[model samples]
Target: MTESTIITDNFLLSNKKAVLLYHEYAKHLPVIDFHNHLSPLQIAEDKKFDNLTDIWLKGDHYKWRAMRALGVDERFITGQASDEEKFKAWAEVVPATLRNPLFHWTHMELKNPFGINSYLNKDSADRIYLQANERLAQDEFSARSLLKNFKVEMLSTTDDPCDDLTHHQQLIKEGYEIKVKPSFRPDKVFMIGEPVTFKAYLKVLGQKAGVEITTIASLLEALKNRVDFFALQQCSISDHGLSTLPTHFTLSLAQEQEFKTFLKSDQAVFSDPDAFAGFILTELCKMYHERNWVQQFHVGAIRNNNPRMLHKLGPDTGFDSIGDYKHAENLTAFLSHLNLTDQLAQTVVYNLNPADNEVIATMLGNFADGRIKGKMQFGSGWWFLDQKDGIEKQLNALSNMGVVSTFIGMLTDSRSFLSYSRHEYFRRIMCNLFGSEMEAGLLPDDEKWVGEMIQNICYYNAKNYFGLNRG
Candidate 1:
């Protein structure tokens, strides 16, 4: 009815049943963001922003990509421009991003935290900026405060194998109310594509794990040590970023020895890189299962396309795109490899390419070992596929292929503090999908049962599945 209520009570719920289901059951649930790339240091430090630009535009490649598409200058997009200039640049691009998810996400972030109700454009930008900045300057608008406003009961920020998790420890020392835990992300460790970096990464891992990795077996031991260390910090999950699953292969000891020597050399080891990645990943997963940690695989992202920008700006500055890699056979083989030894942990599979939605949806069932409820989950739409269409497609595929009732749903997978509003957006969509089905008589007209399903998908499922305060 008004700017204050633009994304109000009935934002995405198209029918009476959906609205009733949402406000009654789903809207009040706390968020369980089990997978994300949020900075643990920011949460630990509880940093406050000086202006809208620092929190909104800086380090947000989603905005960077949109601004680039609108022909904004590199100086404003990612260069030495002032915060005011960068905000102005983003303001200019917001109007042009009419149908993009950026448009909705921009508004939700604004409305939820800053209470700003104006559409962002050249005309409204300065007013919105000053008002939002005024709110951010308050004591209640700090990073942790923002998360508190969104009711984030628990979150897991991504971390490297070599990290000491000092910030996670700090959160515990301060007794922060919301649970901020680490998810073990060892992409760099499994990444042997950059042979030079692989050797360098191994040295760092050795120092952290207190073991010199001179052989394949020794490397596995080093990683297992880190997993043990991470477990001590209450880490309950592991995430991998892969272009596709490695082709199932294991090297002989003589070949493994040769590969270990090759890691010490300056030359790239193209000699069965798949086997190398597969070996390291399989071994790590065994440790993961032993620790009873959930494993997540984010597959089908083709990252760092522009070497020119990559050199100047570095990775995750929006040079990435969806990869077209075939995932079915290799993915099956990879999961099967872990399962054959009874070592497959609770896994959530995320696909960036929508074409693989059904392929992944069905593949999840093959590894259901009856060890845990929803032991194998088709993860929420990730990265490039986190929009409304992509989100719906993932829900549809999972509902058709698996038991959607037990499905753990909706993670930001984002680096922004303001991104928690995404859970609200996702809950709205989930309600609308279920609501539409009920309105059409596809699902039973039981409000209590269906409403609880909405709650479980929004919060309880992830909270219970991840074993956070589950009593």
Candidate 2:
């Protein structure tokens, strides 16, 4: 029998225009991954995986979730099972993930790196495993080479405020080919939902900045210092993962007593403190604007739902899901608070919930004041919504409500090195959309015009938007 088609040359491109757009324009553009969870340390260290499972199975919550759903034992996923066992377990789940994005991503990763074209299943598990592991033993499959294989031009890694960014500094000193920059992700500091942990985080930030975090003012100041430090390290982007935007707008709690009262309030629960989050984000955005930096908000993920598994495996082990939280009012208020002062930085807003796609797309246009082309971006499909359908919806929503042409595009937002295939996956879907428009007479059949637009969305837009060409 013929093998399943997952990573074909014309995969997902239905029409002539799409196939041409993808092959001519989108295919060869280098990726600019502006936001991701990739470890700078691994890149700096030039870490080499011992086997395919070491790179593919480990820390990949996407695969872990699928394996668990297939009733594969936990030992084979995020447990004490050997690497070979985990690979076999994932192979078992791959066949069951037919309609899921993982099936395609799995195949794309296999084909791109290992050149393994066979379907991953119970029948082919052992052979594919040995073949991939044997290939991993080679020099080109190292972490850095894997990035180079994807032609990743530059990538911004999500980093905590308390992080020293020593690894980023090391990469700069090593003079690696791809630019790996750190993006300030101070979500935990404002995550006053866990006051005790938040307070501990505050102490760490204070120590990092050589300041005392007694109130919100000091906290913001300490954060500003860290932002300055990150800037010194050539960092130019800030990222936040939030459930919803905050409603309150107390600029800086002027009175000490009021600040103390608010700080000590029982309002800090499992839910994010909207008032505090909005206020802090408003202030942080100003700092970003001051530095001519970009800010990204990954909103509406309800994380760590399974208490039992959360206690055992910890967060980001695939226990998160899309949240239906109302984010418009607070997100609008937060951006407005910054825009009125003319301190709103170039922003990218990403929502996990597909329901909020248009909400965010429309909301972004409210803040773009013609200064920059795509000053405020309705970001690409994110988190649970990065698949084909999700990509189509986000592209359509942005195209309908805002300027999709100038939109900064795909990022892995993942921990694994092999995940850069996601950019290719997104580009194929994007070209198909634009190509179909041309074929249907919706867009003129000017391949040159539409082709450049495809390149802009795939690479150039992000390159210009992030000032990647500036230095």
Go through the candidates in order and give the C-alpha RMSD of each one to the true structure. Answer: 1.6, 2.2
Question: lDDT score, residue 145, model 2?
Answer: 90
TM-score of each: 0.97, 0.96
* lDDT measured at residue 419 in model 2 versus the true structure, 0 to 100: 93
Give all candidates' CA lDDT scores.
0.88, 0.87
Q: Best by TM-score, which number? A: 1
The residue-by-residue lDDT of candidate 2 on 78-125, one tens digit each, is: 989899888888887788898899999999999998898878988889
Name the lDDT of candidate 2: 0.87
- Candidate 1: regions farther than 4 A off: 1-5
